[model samples]
Target: MLNRVLAVALAAGLVAGLAIAVLQHFTTTPLILAGEAFEKPAGHASLDPAAGLRFSGATIILAHSHGEGAHDEAGWSPTDGLERTAFTSLATVVTAIGFALILMAGLVLSGDPIDGRRALAWAAAAFIATGLAPALGLAPELPGSAAAPLLARQIWWMGTAVATAAALWLLIRTPGLWAKAAGLLLLLAPHVIGAPRPEVYASGAPAELAGAFAATSLVVNAALWASVAVAVGFFWQRFKPHAS
Candidate 1:
């Protein structure tokens, strides 16, 4: 069981990560670069591509520190072309694998039968819990966008994800009406509490451009999760005979 789970996760993560990286390279990457144009001051150095799809916070785009040219002064980052692409792909793959492991563990715990169709449902739930739910309160932002403190945002994001996941499990897996009612409350609790926010809304990027980036990021992340499901489903079926 352990070996089968790891194998499926590895394969799914690779496929999803590569797919997302390619999509982002053409889509979100350009938007991020354009947003950075607004972020750079008269003489400040450019920020790195490290702001996208990190495993941390379940966010497609992360908030970048814009004050004092902190992006440049913080530490070494991959340069603009192939190096950045390589780093992004690596980070994405690692993040995908982490997510995959979580999904696989849930499957194990649930003891549910696995297939492409079923896995697709699971992936959609995962996307909602980890991506869309939190995004409702905290949309993806470009580097120059104003944001609350990172730690606070992280805490809220995690809470939202956990709440959403538990709610989903209750709604889908449990049968009682009480379970459904509890699920509904859990689903709404995070949004009711609200996400952390900056006192003032500000950004170096234009409103139009930032909106575009947020929408594009959500699309890319959706594709990533879907791809993971397809890959996991494929691998799980393929390896079933050998799983024991």
Candidate 2:
């Protein structure tokens, strides 16, 4: 069963990740490059070395928003064009694989028969938890955007995702009014606590461009999640007997 699950998830992740990478190259990449133009002029002081440019699977979720002082040559980054695309694609595929694994785990935990439709439902829920929930507080940001400290924002992001996931599970899996009420409160607690924010909400990017980038990023991420769902669902269905 474990082997079957891994097989399904790996295949699904590769397909979805490659698809998303292509979609992002066309959609979000242009916006990012445009935003970079608005970033601080080349001479600005570089920030922490640890936070330097890193192209990794977590980049999509953790650091999509490039903040001030984050674009120094002190750190290595994939050059624009083919190299950048290759790294981005690789990172996205790995990220998608992780997501697929988590989704499969959820199915296993629920002990429900997995199929494309069911996998999609799970993916939708996952999106709401990992994507939309945190985004409520921290909309997708662009290069040159004002942001709170990276560590603070990361802590909040992870908390929001976990809290939202737990709240969702409680709301959907448990019965009773109290449980439902608690779940609702849990869902709202993170927002109520508030997301970390910069002292000043400033950005070098034009307001219109920033807005467009945020919207586009969200849409692209949604597509990625949906793609993962479809792929995973198809593969799971194909290996249902082994999975069970």
**Clash number by candidate, in order:** 0, 0
Tens digits of per-residue lDDT, candidate 1, 100-152, equal 88778777788877877777888899999999999999999987778899999
Pairs of residues clashing in candidate 1:
none
Model 1 regions more than 4 Å off:
40-72, 242-244
Tens-digit per-residue lDDT, 1-244, candidate 2? 8999999989999999999998989888898888775565323433333563233312221122334444453355766679889998999999999989999999999997788788888988899999999999999998868889999999999999999999998999899999899999999999999999898776757789988988898888788788988998899877767423
For candidate 2, what is the lDDT? 0.83
> Local error of candidate 2 at 174, Å?
0.8
Q: Candidate 2, TM-score vs. the true structure?
A: 0.85
- For candidate 1, give the lDDT of residue 162: 97
